[model samples]
Target: MERSRIAVAGASGLIGGALVRALTADGHEVVRLVRGAARAADEVRWDPERGSVDADGLAGCGAVVNLAGAGVGDRRWTPAYKARLRASRVRGTAALAEAVAALPEEVRPRVLLNGSAIGYYGETGGRTVDESAPPGEGFLPGLCVEWEAAAAPAREAGVRTVFARTGLVVARGGGAWGRLFPLFRAGLGGRLGDGRQYWSFIALHDEVAALRHLLDTEGLSGPFNLTAPYPATNREITETMARVLHRPALFAVPAPVLRTVLGEMAGDVLGSARVVPARLLESGFRFAFPRIEEAVRAAL
Candidate 1:
């Protein structure tokens, strides 16, 4: 495969860092779109909140991956925090799209892989959702809706836009699973809410691999649900984690306590999204770890 010049926003983030590593491994030249001081010579500093970016820095780039966004689970959903969450994604994506749109047709990157989440589907219970499923009417889904719409400029400019609707990426190193490992080892980790809500997950390695696959496969466009083939319930995930770590997973976190503790954010933890990789499978992309057990074991 021919190498391409890839520019990545949010290069400091988990997914962005993994993508940089993967792209470099695949012999692509990576230019990191940073925010603050130019830490490295190759870094392109931009402030999405301020709607500013170095457009010239993006020139000649063959591809761009927009992963800039506020951390969803980082804080309690205060009205202000929620607004920031929405603005962060919308504004950042719009900034990239605008920059790309300003470029001449031939020089502009051919593809833009924008970040999104399975939360776009809202609480699915046991109903299997794919990219073809309509957007759910809820906070997260609404957030995702606006988030994807923010990239319209790029799509209008004839760029092949891909919305990667990611799931809970399980990684041993400082990801969601890593944060829960200590608690689980101490026997404090248990199912959240009723434990019946479905939890879609993907190994960090496979998540990165899937993104690369999306980038390489020209036929893939629009939204792709980046999840494992085999979806599991919250109880299944917790119990599997316990079994993998040789610990017990008997306790359960009630919904009321979660609601009181997390407020509106509690709904996110309690909600179920039984998402499937319909587009990915149809595109002939095979999952390295299709089952939760395989993903958990690999991450552990």
Candidate 2:
């Protein structure tokens, strides 16, 4: 592949950090679209809150990956925090899209992989859905709808944009799965609620690879599910973790208790989304770890 400059927002997060490393490792020029003043030649300043980006810095880029968003499960879903979540994603994405749109047609990137989530499908209740399914009800799904729409500017500009609907990324260092490993290791880990909700998960490495795959694959555009082919239930995932770590996943967090503890965020924790990577598979993208067991082992 020919080397090209790629601008990436949110370069400090788990997926973003890994993607930056992977792109640079392959000799691709990576420009970091960071929040705040530019600290280095490779770092370009952009403030999503202000809807400002270094358009000149991103001029003539080959591709742009916008992974800017707040952690959904990081805090309680107080009205203010929920607002923060929407703003961080919707505003940040619109800012990036506008910046890319400002570029000359010839200089515009070939693709824009705007980050999204499987929450677009809302609570599936063990029902499987793919990218083709319509957006569901609830705050998360509603937020995801707006989140993906924020990239309309870039899409309208004819940049082959992709809504990268990512699922629970199983990594040892960060994300919900990162938080899970330690608890399971301590033998304090257990399934949430009824342990019946479906979890569409991807290994960290596979998640990065899939994003890179989308970057290179030009024929693909629009929403694509970046999850394992075989999604497992919460109970199945819990059992796998226990077996993989040789620890007893002996406890169960009750639904009402979780609701009381997590507040509005409990709905998502207990929601079921049996997602499938139909688009990714049909596009000929292969998964390095398609099974939950494989993903668990990788996370371990």
* lDDT (C-alpha, whole model) for all candidates: 0.88, 0.92
Candidate 1 lDDT, tens digit per residue, 1-300? 269888999888888888899899888999998888768767888888777788877888888998888899888999999989987898889999999989988789889999999999997878998888999987899999999999999999889999999999988775578788888889888999889988899998899999999898986789999999899988888988899889888788899999999999898889888999998999988988999889988886
TM-score per candidate, chains pooled? 0.97, 0.98
Question: What's model 2's overall lDDT?
Answer: 0.92
Model 2 has a clash total of 0
lDDT of 2 by residue, 1-300 (tens): 368999999899999999999999999999999887999988889887667888888888899999988899999989999988999899888988988988998888888899999999998886789988999998999999999999999999998999899999999989989899999999999999999999999999899999998999778899999999999999999999999999999999999999999998899889899999999999998999999999989877
TM-score of 1: 0.97
Summed backbone clashes in each candidate are 0, 0
Model 1 lowest lDDT segment of ten: 171-180
